[model samples]
Target: MTNRAGRTGTLNEELLRKAATLQEALPYLRRFAGEVFVIKYGGHAMGDDTLAKAFAENIVLLKQVGIHPVIVHGGGPQIGRMLERLKIHSQFVDGLRVTDRETVDIVEMVLSGSINKQIVSAIQLAGGMAIGLSGKDGALIQARKLTRSKADPDSNIERILDLGFVGEPRHINPDIFNAIDLDAVIPVIAPIGVGKNGETFNINADSAAGAIASALGAAKLIMLTDVAGVLDKDGQLLPVLTPRDVLVLRGEGVITGGMIPKIETCLDAVRNGVGAATILDGRVENVILLETFTEHGVGTMIRRDDPADGEGG
Candidate 1:
């Protein structure tokens, strides 16, 4: 009898915990209703099946609760693997892939065709309506060539490095979104843009997501990355930050490498009218829920206000 009673007690405790979790989420649901959230979905999470399904379900839940979700996905590793299989020599300068004409065609095929459809299928399987499109669709994103300059070690002269077909978003047409019923279907976007003269360009996914978020004036821009948010010098995650804090961290060399671009993207989104931007580790199951519903969010949040304003992560 004691054992049976203990089992019953344990089940009751588990039920109570779940109830508490739902109760905690109620206020967040109320606040975010009818708001738009732009999610940059990628990293190791995309490669894993379980994590991807969890992500899709979380997005569906958000939509059901009246929050619109727009997904911008990256497929760098997938692209690299495909290039290797085809014996195509791929190169990168400052983490931006140098895409030639042939490379750009392959990039478009992978991003807009395979990866994009796969995500759409995943969402559909998770009981959500999803439509996959590229930045080229409906004249969505206009892009321009991205140029970089590096100083020669010996001559001390800066020379331009041509990253062929690699482009940045020059403009975003928010009008295209107006035609779609965001309340019914989620838009999954591939980060490939079209140049003015009908040229195809490969765009960095993080930059693409930021530009879209800025154009939409989304309530939040959530970056799902591989890391555990922004870290301090000692490699601990900092939960909250302001734009000034980001600049300070960059100046201190604490933010470098690939993280630099992600941070810059977040900064750009917020500066361009996004309410807040968060860098989250996508490997954690239901990470989006943890960040949105919980009082103390899991990842690092960047707000426009200073810490002194009492607005934290």
Candidate 2:
């Protein structure tokens, strides 16, 4: 009788914990209702089956809660894999893939065709309505070709190297989203833009997401990355950061390597009218829920230094 009673007690405790979690989420639900959240979903999370399903479900949950979600996805690893399979030579300068005419075609095929539809299917399977679109659709994102300059170590001479078909977002058309019923359907976007002269350009997913968030004036811009938020020198997560803090961290070399671009994206979003930007570790299950709904967030939140700008978070 005692053993049965203990088992029943444990079940009750579990139920109570779940109830408490719901209770904690109540205020956040009220606050974020009717707000748009632009999420940059990528990294190891997109590659893993279980994590992909979890991400899709979380996005659906956000929609169910009345928060509109717009997704911008990255497929770097997938693109590289495709390039290798096709026997196409690929090169990277400063982490941006040098996309000649041939490689850019392959890039668009992987990013807009396969990866975009896969995410849409995942979301649909999770009981949500999802529409997949690339930057080219509806003139969503107009882009300019990107060029890089490298300085000679000994001569200190700088020479420009054109990265064919690699581009940065020149403009984002807000009107395209104005027609969508964001309350009902989620838009999954591929970071593939078109130039003015009808040229297709491959864009960086993080930069595209930041530009979209800024153009939409989204309430939150969340980046789902491989690492645990922004870590300090000791490898501890910094829960919250301001623009000033980011500058200081960069100067200190605490924010280095690939993290630099992610942090810069977050900073750009917050600086350009997005309410708040966060970098969350996509490895964690239900990380978006933990970051948005819970009081103690699970990632690094970047907001304006002013208290008034900390509205959505």
Candidate 3:
């Protein structure tokens, strides 16, 4: 009888712990009710089937709890694989693919046709209504060609490199989002945009997501990357950061390479009226839930001068 009683006690303790977790999440659910969360889903997470399903479940749960989720996805690895299978050689300038006309077509196919629909289907299968969209749809993201300048090391002369069909978002139209029932539907967006001349441009997914988050005045902009958020010099994750902190880190060369642009995107989004922005590791299961509903968040959150805001520890 004592052994049975001990087993029952342990089972009850487990149940109580789960109940406590739910109780802790209740306040956050109330706080984020009817708020929009823009999620940029990419990196290694997209390639993993298990992580993808978990991501879909996370989105559905957020919607079921009255929070709207907008997803922007990237397909760099998939695009490269497609290009290779087709025997199409590609080149990159300053980490931006020099997308010629043919390459841009394939980019659209991979991004809008394959990847976008896959994400939508995942969400739908997870019991949520998901609508896939491109920036060209409803003129959502109006874009212009991106120009990059590189200096010659010998003469120190700057020259602009024309990356054909590679564009940056000039504007985002939030009316398209309003047309859908945000409460009942999730929007999965591809970063392909249309230029003023009616030319299709391949915009960076991070840039497009930032613009969309800013335009919608979203409560949170979450960027899911392979890294475990921003790390300190000793490789410890910085849980919370301000704009000034980010700038200092950049100035000290701690933030470099591709991370620079991602940090800049977060900074721009928060500065342009988004409530907060975060960079987290998507490789972990249920990372979104860990960041949103728990006291101990899993990433680096950047806010505007408000140290009191966001998750701690």
Q: What is the C-alpha lDDT of each candidate?
A: 0.92, 0.94, 0.93
152-171: candidate 1 lDDT, tens digit per residue: 99999999999999999999
Model 3 error, position 174 (Å):
1.3
Candidate 3 accuracy as lDDT: 0.93
How large is the C-alpha RMSD of every model relative to the true structure?
1.6, 1.3, 1.7
Task: Enumerate clash totals for all models, in the order shown.
Answer: 0, 0, 0
Output the number of the TM-score-best candidate.
2
TM-score of 3: 0.97
> 71, model 2: CA deviation in Å?
0.4
Q: lDDT, candidate 3, residue 205?
A: 96
Q: List the candidate numbers ranked by lDDT, top first.
A: 2, 3, 1
List pairs with backbone clashes in candidate 2: none
Evaluate residue 108 in candidate 3 and report its C-alpha lDDT on the 0 to 100 scale: 97
lDDT per residue as tens, model 3, 1-313 = 4799889999999999999989888888998999999999999899999999999999999999999999999999999999999999999987899999999999999999999999999999999999999999999999999999999999999988989999999989888987989988899999999999999999999999999999999999999999999998888999888989988998888888999899999999988988889999999999999999987778999988876654332
